[model samples]
Target: MYIRERRRFVAMSLAAITLGACAETSVRPRQLAGADPARGRDAAERVVCAACHEIPGIAWPRGRMGGSLAGFGGRPLIAGRLPNQPDILVRWVRDAPSLIPGTGMPPQDLSPAEARDVAAFLYTLE
Candidate 1:
């Protein structure tokens, strides 16, 4: 019985090790082949996000319209709420009202590629 128990424990440990090694982390992608902050800024300007949102230096209607995006990399959440995970930002950017009903920020019409680029730029605001 003692030998059998030891064998079972070893088998379990091996299985645990295998599972841990196979597990994938949930971190987001930081960059793409040609991610440009200047391009992203241009896109940001195109959407006129700063027109109502207080986005960093490109301020418009102050008082936290959508709040500043400076130091966005250090933030754990966006819009004073929601996790700052890259995927979450993608969703928010793509469909703000859908992510959170009654959210003050409007859903800016950005294509998938454009949104990704914008996210890449935002990620760099550390």
Candidate 2:
């Protein structure tokens, strides 16, 4: 247990350092053209997204339930089923349950634009 805690602390520290470097820069979103990454970063916090997913930029969550999105940009699939492409990613971000019935996530209630922006921010993670 002590080792686990120590590892967690180290990993969290590394994540903070890595994300701090990219705090001001915006990666061009591949999923949706013209999607604003900065807005996406803010929207993720506004929506309390880290409640489910371990997002890279914001460090508070460290969610235990959902998977970490540390390298979402390079991932090959969305839910281990759908291909991680632009249109599909945008839709998945907005409504995971719509794509996969009985999915654990509830309706995210994000607008189309907000979803696009959130998706953009997710894709920025290296």
Candidate 3:
């Protein structure tokens, strides 16, 4: 009976360890260490973030145009609705124009991965 109990305990422990290992096997997001502004600019281009909003390095409208997202990270609220968290930012990037009416910013239509990358890039600013 003692031997059976020990075997069961060992099996459960092994299973728990295997599950923990699996949980850690996902692609870790890049650390939030200050990213290269230039690379972020490139990422903005790839995601076409400048199509609506004026990004840092992308060639944007010369005159009075869309709202300047220069200090977007510092903003207290997104469109005065959602708080600026990574998940919230991803959601906003994925669907903003729909989320808010009369918002000049149109949805850039990014995938989950693309949105996450953009969020990481944006967090680098200040």
Which candidate ranks first by lDDT, i.e. highest?
2
Query: Could you give candidate 2's per-residue lDDT for residues 1-126 as a string of tens digits?
Result: 999999999999999965753442233335477899899889888878799888888987777577888998877667777756666777988889889898877667688998888888888896
Global CA lDDT computed for model 3: 0.63
Candidate 3, after superposition: displacement of residue 75 in Å? 1.7
**Tens digit of lDDT per residue, candidate 3, span 19-126?**
754444232432434434455556668766665566665675432355657766665556667556666676677777666766766677566666666777765554
Q: What's the CA RMSD for each of the models?
A: 7.9, 15.0, 10.7
Q: Candidate 3: list runs displaced more than 4 Å.
A: 1-40, 61-65
Tell me model 1's lDDT, rounded to 2 decimals: 0.69
Task: Give the total clashing residue pairs for model 1.
Answer: 0
lDDT of each: 0.69, 0.78, 0.63
Mark the 10 consecutive residues where model 2 has the least summed lDDT.
20-29
Residue 32's lDDT within candidate 3 is 33
Clashes of each: 0, 0, 0
Q: Give every collision pair in model 3.
A: none
Give me candidate 3's TM-score against the actual structure.
0.56
Q: Give the Å shift of residue 71 in candidate 2.
A: 0.3
